[model samples]
Target: MTGEPVLLTCDSGGVRTLVLNRPHRRNALDAELWEALRSALVDAGADRSVRALVLTGAGDAFCSGADLPKRPSTAHPLHRMRTLTEVTLLLHELPMPTVAKVTGVAVGAGWNLALGCDLVIAVPEARFSQIFARRGLSPDCGGTWILPRLVGLQQAKRLALLAETIDAGEALSRGLVTWVVAAADVDAFTDDVTARLAAGPPVALAQTKALLNENTDRTLREALAGEARAQAVNFATADAPEAYAAFAEKREARFTGRWAVPTRTEDDA
Candidate 1:
């Protein structure tokens, strides 16, 4: 908590929340902050107890993209870009669900980071922009890839080219964000959504997320095969049995994050 940590982390009810802590620069990503975020995400992916993750900013703005270094740096610029790539991929491919809680401005790499999450919950006053063009830069952090997939190639091109700012309602209509609520309700709504995700079966949710994410790259036959495999894997987990038992007992299932399936003996096989 000391020494002005660039990222803040908190865990509650199986949800791990990561807040970008650079409010003075609108939570901009500096080299140190980028590395810190990458490490935090990698750790979260490996932690079974962290059933879901919520990402947000400390102040009014979610993020304003990368901070401009005041002077020429000794380090190669591409190194930072490479790090951003790794961070975005980690967010996209995390096993558990990830949510972005966006309030104020989310522009450039910041907006792309939100897009990388499985879901985004934004307040009505939230503002978003693919501001790379305005900055004389092309999109990075998987913006080019994710934007086209979410909003179609033409719309993506227009947004990327124009660099026009859009409000939360427009973002929701364009499929840029999952949900938009009043600023006053954002905290309550995000908490409810994250809690629901945290309470779900971890293995099943992970499988579902993987299946959907890979769908665009897969043929129909391949997709079906993948679904079959995913379902088989889900069935092997304790959660499947727990769900059936819960159904019979007319009660909620208690998922324990136990995914290991017992090895079958010859007789059982």
Candidate 2:
């Protein structure tokens, strides 16, 4: 534990997988892993080649939430929470798609972490809980906001107020997880799903994600205006033309996400 990195990173097929590496503690996030996650997310956001991202853990468990034994910071509680807030915002707002691959325990902030991703693929053995009330704390890491949105207020209350651990099947039924795959097939399924997402038109996907995230607050008029702007931006990328051509030719579109808008040259100036 002394020399091993708190987070492990891997890149393959345009996907970046960030593994939470504290398995001995059920991959509970500590100060070091939190900072590492922030750095990794920033790097991924800046690298357009990384079209998809995956968040998982090293051993059996995905995460058991923040490590209670280790006090991560001596600063004020507000300052400490800001670190978590940053990580939450980064994961939620990443331009590319994100997936959470949960195998075992995903509780407290860990469950919220999975919820923050665009999709969650959990194995049959996966267990989830809010676990905040038990810890005498309310939800953090965007749980308070995301839970109600995903499962509705009543169910969200049942989870947060009671902090009951729910199994994978129940989680799926309650909309806590996107899919509950067999433990044997989780790796292959995750790879296939991420690859398919990566192969899609990046510009359109990003815009779509943004649109959905903002939809909750915007009015009908505002939402339509946003979509119009998004479509205009999409047309300025190489993906839109490729999509049209592929549709006409009845072939799969290979989107490159290359910018196609004309640049102002010295002569134009």
Candidate 3:
């Protein structure tokens, strides 16, 4: 996982695929890989050419965990924790929709990374685990915060406390993953979703994401007001006109907005 090349490439329909390239290490996140991934995510979010992102791994495993060899580093432990927190926050704050395509084992921080995405589509063969407990450590990479929100508090406790591996079927059933396709179909399914999102209204999607992330923490009055404000802004976009016109013309709407919007600052649960 050390000094591994980050696999980043954008295709037609504005789908940017960030593949974890360290197959030998099961795509573990070493310090270098973390920085590379942070930079790549930042660049993709800023690039208008990239409307959607599909985060996946290179070979058999989606990701194992943080690179164990890099632990207890030259820097202070608290510094490492702070750095990891910022990196995880960056992933969660990306403007465009991110979909994690999990095909194999996604353990510890790897699982958390996938959970950070707006949606996760995994293959039947994929497995997920929060193995930090097994290794005599606490969870990192937004796992502690995101897991409880995804699955209930009890489920989150089970995952973190037991540190046991669960398969894709269980993950989907527990509301952790959005969908579970066959192993051969995971890539194609993710591609289809990404393409669909890319062709849709980018501003609307971003607004929806923003609302979702803030909804649980906001009061009902505040949430409604926020939605109305967001809707007001979205209605003024070019895509909104095209959408109404397409409806009247009995055709599909072709949306094209690509700029990133400012993420709303809100307190987390």
Candidate 2: residue 214 lDDT (0-100) = 91
**What's the ranking of the predictions by lDDT, best on top?**
2, 1, 3
lDDT of each: 0.93, 0.93, 0.86
Question: Mind giving the per-residue lDDT tens digits that candidate 2 earns over 34-92?
Answer: 99999999999999999999999989999999988453556889888888999999999
Off by over 4 Å in 1: 264-269
Badly placed stretches (over 4 Å) of model 2 are 70-73, 266-269
Q: Which candidate would rank higher by lDDT, 1 or 3? A: 1
Give a tens-digit lDDT track for model 3, residues 55-144: 889899889998888445697888767767877888888888999999889999999999999999998889999999999999999888
> What's the TM-score of every candidate structure?
0.95, 0.97, 0.91
Instruction: Report the lDDT of model 1 for residue 213.
Output: 97
**What is residue 116's positional error in candidate 3, in angstroms?**
0.5
The regions of model 3 sitting more than 4 angstroms off are: 1-4, 258-269
Give lDDT for model 2. Answer: 0.93
Give the TM-score (vs. native) of candidate 3: 0.91
Q: How accurate is candidate 3 locally (lDDT)?
A: 0.86
**Number of backbone collisions per candidate:** 0, 0, 0
